[model samples]
Structures are given as structure tokens and as C-alpha cells.
Target: MNFNFLSPVSDSVLAHNELLSAQVLGRKLHIHSKQNGIPDLDGVSIAILGVLENRNDVNYIGEEFELNEIRKSFYALFPGSWNTIIADLGDINKGESVEDTYFALKETISVLVKKNIIPVILGGTQDLTYANYRAYDTLMPMVNLVNVDCKFDLGDSQKPIKNNSFVGKIILEEPYNLFNYATIGYQTYFNSQEEIDLMNKLYFEAYRLGQVSKDITIVEPVLRDANIVSVDLSSVKGAEVSLKQKYSPNGIDGKEICAIARYAGISNKVSSFGIYEYNPSKDDELTSMLVAQMIWYFVEGVNCRVKDDDFSNEDYYQKFITLVDEQELIFYKSLKTGRWWIEIPFLSEVNNKLKRHTLLPCMHQDYIDACNSNVPERWYKAFQKNCL
Candidate 1:
């Protein structure tokens, strides 16, 4: 029998330490420890956490990727880094129970954030997002979340621990505001209208890629204020390729997908990010290579932002807003003096012309009143400011 799954670690020729000791492109890595002979990145708190094993026996596992393959790929793409990737080899299927994975994830995240490290998580399923959010609970007072997926993953969990609707349970239980969350690339077939309606009712931002394919420029401002980003690979495509989803056909492509990932990474506000639904059995070598490339670009975006920049918030806001053109879409910029006035796209009402800005933060209730009422005339006249 192929007893590679004997335990979390193996005592074979290619020891776990030997496999995980590869370097990243430009940065030096530090391997922390070798528990059970599985190599942990030393001094490198930032991580790419992959919950590949689950106790629920949910048929989520497809084919597993070789650690050597992933490590070598990372080294080729990022040559100078000492250690940027690590995997948990614990026998996730020891039983059909929740296991200590959730606790381990929570502790791991706490350690990284405390040390100012960014964690790039890969999911066994969408359930990991809930655990991730929970990890950040005490650390972040107010969090802005961006979800790029085909479905809301909000099915009723009363039946079983389904990945479908676990996020719903999380939102209902957490004090976080729905408006702070944005769901991008939603497909009509994957989600119910009721789910969509529920999202809108909760004031969550939701965008349909069916309507905005090339106009993804609008994504800039939407995420400019967000602190967390979670991605589901199913949102990209479901094909037989190594990295594609099993059920999705209509989705974004590799290059365009990377652009979006780069966007999120460059935002600098992102504390945590994830990619889900990768089946190594179904994945092509090219697909595996692309996964490594995507991870590289993610780190590239992270390194681009400087920590001590003092650019006025207005500067970033204006720059992000300028990314959207009025020629293609009729969006009115709501400008309030001495307060942040975000661009609100009246998309559903606009001749169905402009790409909708979903999950965008509207100003406070008072500002909303002003934007809705005739107060703009007084405010406009008071400040000799021109509305572009």
C-alpha cells in the first residue's frame, strides 16, 4: 500500500526538513522547528497555511501535490528567499472529528499577526475562512473583508458542517457588519436569488462578473479600505486542469486572475488571504506551475507596500476613484467636506450601463441623507468645489 499517509511525518529518504528547506526568490527564510520531522519555516512567521486534510470525510480531497514539487516551484520563482512556504503534515483524517486543526490555525494566525507577518492560506474547503476570521477577532476591532468566489458559501449548516453556508453562521454570530464584506465574481448558477437578496438586505457588497468582465478596474476603490481578502479557486474555473475547480466552467482566467490577486496584495491593508479548491489529481503540471506563480505574485504585492508612508488618505481615495471612468459608467462621486465620501454607483438604476460597485462603504447615515436629499446643492455652493 502507498503508506505515505502513515502519520503527519515520515522517516523516509526525502526527510520533511530536506523538502521544506528550499529558498524563496529574493528573501532569506528561517525554518523554525522540525516537529515529527515536518519542517516549519524558521524565523519566518508569514506563511501559506494549507488545510488539506479534514476529519469530516466530505469528499473534498482530490489528489495531493508533492511537497518537493511545491518547494522547488517556489525556489524557481523566488530564488533568494531562504524559506517562504511550509505545510502541516499532521494526519488530518485520524478521525472524522474536527480535530485540533482549528485551534492550530487560530494559534498560527495569532503568532504571525503579532509578529507583523502576513499569512497566505490555502483551503481544504471554504470552512477555513470562518476559522481565519475567528483567529482575527480580538486583534482587529473593525475588519473589512473581500471575498472573491462564485457562491456566498452561506448554506444552512443545520444539516451538517457544509462549506456552503458556514460563512452565514459566522456573520450571524459575529458582531461584524455585513456592509464591511464584499463578494466579487458571483455566478448565477452557483447561488440562489434568496442568498443574493439576503446579502443585499444585510447591506453587503456583491458584484456579478457576468456583468463586469473587463471593467474590473472598479475593484480598486472597493478594496482600498479592506483589511482581509479570501479567495475561492472555484471562482476562477472548474476544469480538468490541476488548479481548476471541478464544477465551474464560466470564470476568470490565469493572467486576469493574477491581476486581481495583485490588486488585493498591493492594497497593503490585507491582513490575510486564501485560495481554495485545488485538486492535484485533476491539475496539470502547467496548472501546478501557475499555482506557484500566483503565490509569487501575491508576495510581490505584499512587499511593494511601505509601512511608514504618510500619504494622505484623501490621496489614496482620489487615486482609487479616478480608476473608474464616467464615460463607461454613470457614477456620481459623493463629496462631503471634512469627511470621507465614497463613490456610490447607482448601477441598478443607471441605464444598466455602469459596472456596479458592490459591497462599497457608503458614508454614515447622515451623509447618506445628504447624498439622497437636496443638501448637495447647499454643500456644493458653500465650497466652490467642482463635481467631476
Candidate 2:
């Protein structure tokens, strides 16, 4: 039993009416209570874990866990058309130090992911994403991470890691498995010019808030390419979440964030998901319910996921090849889901951990760009990263 790594949800949090309504998810969730044992993982597709540590946040002055409030709001909501078993593993209280909490989270998430159970993390701070990424170190050869936030958070690698600088640690740390990092809804005023330039120099992708709000569907292809998704509630408008940081007056609204969450859940490559920077206050109910709805959309997306990775079987996909810059660009569209992918030629032997995949996820737009003789930057970056 990994019970040592977690604490049962407080009795007060589960004090809801026993009456089970078909709509209320609290009635159906296998919550980890003091009396009941841990839920079986046999058919479970998603596990919810609450974390109560935030010392690493750049603005940290000490904060309380929003778990109970979040729980109250989340449990009261209705589930969508989902058949997957969802379990609440309760909360991880603050450890001795920030690193101590990081250790607990890393160790805990590592085992669950190894078992192929997707963990939907209710987080303390965005810095915990470093631990989320670390959990996949030995499980996979490389990783593709997507962060939904208003800042790149690419603080100095030379300094101690904080919520704003965890990405720098992920990039410079050992067992380097990060292949791609994409940011959605980044605002120009929040990120420094150097950090912005660093993104381009490192070949990472960043979509401005206006770009995403203009075309919400554009985020799906990016999420489809990610392995881990970390979302900062600060990315949402302050009017929506009453954000602690008060970071942005302009941000993605409630609907867009949930859409992004659903897209993350729909991605076949996304193994673990996290929602961070939730600071509970007088208006906790409003923010908590919004966050809960986002989680619901993710669960709905998971239930609606369709497998389309098999390109070897000619019957499963339609192939298209276009010549651009004297090089042949190959694309595959899933016959079942209509999703798209582009082939990045692998020069080495097949089946190697690093070579398990050569096809990078793309969108229909990429094919159109290729047809117009414009080489897709994403394809080029993936090609460069793989060949090196």
C-alpha cells in the first residue's frame, strides 16, 4: 500500500448527503476515506491527487491547502458521458521542506504513472511540475511537455528552482528526457524579452493569448503532441479565478481553459495532468467550481479518446505526401479520428527507445502549408532534435 505517501481526505471534506444523484460526481467517486480502503486500480483510467505544499512559489509567504474547498465544489458537479473509473487518492500534506514535498510527489506520481494510471494532480504550485516531469524520467526515453500559463516562467537556471524557474531546471537537469516544451496563452508583458528569445533559440513553441483566444482549436494539435500537461490557474482571467498573483487583466476565460483541458486529456501521448496555482480565498467557491468543471471536461475527453497511432496498417489511415524544398513530406490522417501527424525520418535502427516514434503530431494546416511549399517549423524542429 502506498498509503504512507498520502493522507486520507479529512472527514469534513466528505460530509455530503448520502443521496446519490446521477449528476453529482461525489456520489460515484471512490474517495479515499479513513474507513474505506484504497480504491482498486484494475479498471481505473484516472486518479485525482491533492497536494498541499507551495513554499516554492515565487510569491510564497506560506499558504493553506485549497483541497477541501476544491473538493466541495468538485464533488458537487456532474460527470459527463464517462465510463472510466475515477479515484480520489486524497491529499499530500506539506513535508519537512520544499524538496521533501517534491520527493513525496515525485515518488508518488512515479509509481502511479508506471502502472499506466493517469494522475490528475491538484497542485500547490507550478514548481511541482518539475517533479511531474521527473516521474517520467525512466518510464520513457524523451518527453513533450505543454504548459498553459501567462508566462514562460523560464527564470535563471543558475538560481535555486522556484515556480517561475522550474522549466529551466527541466532543461538543464540530468537524465535529460525533455524533447519539446510548448506554452499556450503566454502574454507579452509577463515574459521578458530574453526569455522570449530563449524560446525561439531553443526551438520551443509559444502561442500568445490572443492567438489562442482567436482560434481555440489550434491548441488541440499542440496538446496532442504533449506527454505531460501543467496548467496554471493564473492563466485564467482574474475575474474568473481571483488569482493570487493578479498577474494579468487579459487572459483566457473559463470556456477556453476548459477546452484546453479537454484537449490535453484527449491527447494519446499525455500520461499525466496537473492544475496548479489555485489559491483559496473569500471567493473560493467560484474559482473551485470553475476548476472542477475543467477537470470534468478532461474526464469527458478521456472517455472520448480514440486510438489512432497505428500507421503501419494501411487501412487505418490515409497517407499524403508532398514535395517541399526538394524533400518529401509525409503526412497521416487517422481514418477514425481525423487527427494528423507528420513523419520525421529516423536514420537509425527501429524499435529503439529513442526511435519508437518518428511521426510528430501536426495539424491539417501543416499539410496545407507544405502543399504551399512552406516548411512547417514544428516539423523542422522535431527533425533537428531527433537527428542530433
The clash count of every prediction, one per candidate, is 23, 0
The TM-scores, one per candidate, come to 0.67, 0.95
lDDT (tens digit, per residue) of candidate 2 on 205-289 = 9999999999999889889889899999889987777545345679999999999999988988889999998888776777888
Candidate lDDT (C-alpha), each: 0.54, 0.86
Which portions of model 1 show Cα errors greater than 4 Å? 1-28, 31-45, 55-68, 79-96, 157-159, 175-179, 306-388
Poorest stretch of ten by lDDT in candidate 1: 378-387
Off by over 4 Å in 2: 17-23, 243-246, 347-357
Clashing pairs in 2: none
lDDT by residue (141-162, candidate 1, tens digit) is 6566788888887777565655
lDDT winner among the candidates?
2
